[model samples]
Target: MGMRVKQLSQLRNRIVVITGATSGIGAVTAAKLAEAGAVPIITGRSASKLAAMRGRVSGRCGFYELDVTDNADVQRVVDRIATDFGRIDVLVNNAGFGLFERFEDAPLEHFAKMMDTNYMGTVRCAKAVLPYMKSQGNGHIVNIASMAGKLSTAKASGYAATKHAVLGLTNALRAELAPDGIAVSAVNPGPIDTPFLETADPGGGYAASVKGYLLKPAQVADTIVRVIAKRTPEVDLPLSAGIGIRLYGLAPRFADKTLGKLLNRK
Candidate 1:
């Protein structure tokens, strides 16, 4: 364990840029990365939360108030980071949200907003950083998707669509950037215990049902930190969840009747 910590600490001074980083998995990952001696540059839509996170993180840290949907602003921030930090070694696209409601009941605007922030926002950030990472000849991009991306569940249709897009991007980008020495990885977690549920499941039904199974933010953060070190291709949290996803993939019709019904808590 000491040797492992030593190995992880080799990231001293490494610049890691994370989006949607003021809370939840993103926020925890920022602190963990800093603990490993890396410089975490956190971005989020909330200035006060960003400031609070900056204050809490140890070692060198950077916090920016950002809305992922703003392409111009994203580019500006990316440019500024590249200029101020000199190089961005890692990018974690964790900025996203979900709203749970039956397809017919959910507002169309909510779907648009989710798509812009969750899918297009990721695209924008990746595009902004690609030039710098490519020029540097190496970098890593870790996208935070969800199990919903792999297995569609009821009441989260819109949210699932956005994550599906992110997963697709992660896979294709991984293959495209391999030769450039830049790595792309996808972290698909199951239900997480965070403020995310407040927004995704405002009615509290889904959260209540999945109470026992929700993964902790710190646990997911540890996985993110490990992915940074290992440059892993893809990771599905909670061994059981991954198994469920695989089973669903193999027998969609059966899963639709069994696992799908069980997962339609929202």
Candidate 2:
């Protein structure tokens, strides 16, 4: 019992920076980390929402208006956080959007937007923080990717592509920063019950397809907390989905045929 308390105490007061913290997974994660006694620095595009989020979370909280897609803004905000906090203990790259549409039918601009916001945004944040983390010689970077990164669906071409890039970046950075004592991990979650669907599938087609199987944002947040506390390498939410994705990797064509049928069901 004493050891458990000690373990929990170790997590207290660590500075954690979270992107896309205005809503969805980012908001939930920030609140949970704060509850665990961590000092959370939350960033998003909306000032009002940022204020409200800061109010909702317990402990010392910092809120910044940031659009992750802006490289200069990301760098400046991250630098300021490092300066204020003395060191950034953890960085959660959770700022991203999804666009669902058939590749042939999707607009080129949509693909560009996803790439910039999801992939490049993560890159920018990581680049900005790497120096501080490397100098400190210890830090954790948690990239919030998705199951679509490992396995793509019909209308999720653009979204999947961006997530795939995130996975790639996470994996590569994990190795690149290892010698510097920095850990990079990826959290690949399946569909979660969030406002993402409103933008990802405006028509509600994909949401309808995944009905009853959606994960809660709190569940993902719990996993993320564990990732930061334990320095877990990679986490795939809903273990079943992770297993299925692995199995699919073993037999691509057959698995795709079988899974496609299941996902296409009405």
Q: What is the C-alpha lDDT of each candidate?
A: 0.92, 0.89
In terms of lDDT, the best-performing candidate is 1
**Residues 1-266 of candidate 1: C-alpha lDDT, one tens digit per residue:** 98678768767888999999999999999999999999999999988898788677999988888788998899999999999899999999999999988899888999999999999999999999999999999999999999999988788899999999999999999999999999999999999999999998887888999899999999999999999987889999987889988887798888788766578877
Clashes of each: 0, 0
| Cα lDDT over the full model 1 | 0.92
lDDT value, candidate 2, whole model: 0.89
Number of the top-ranking candidate, with TM-score as the measure: 1
**TM per prediction:** 0.97, 0.96
Error of 1 at 53 (Å): 1.2
Distance from true position, residue 21, model 2, in Å?
Answer: 0.8
Q: Across residues 1-266, which tens digit of lDDT does each residue of candidate 2 receive? A: 77645655667999999999889999999998888899989999999998788678988988888989888899899988887888898999999999778789989999999999999999999999988988899999999999899988777888899999999999999999999999999999999889988998788877787888899999999899888888898999889999988998899889877777775432
Candidate 1, run of 10 with poorest lDDT: 257-266
Worst 10 residues of 2 by lDDT: 257-266
Name the runs in model 2 displaced over 4 angstroms: 1-7, 264-266
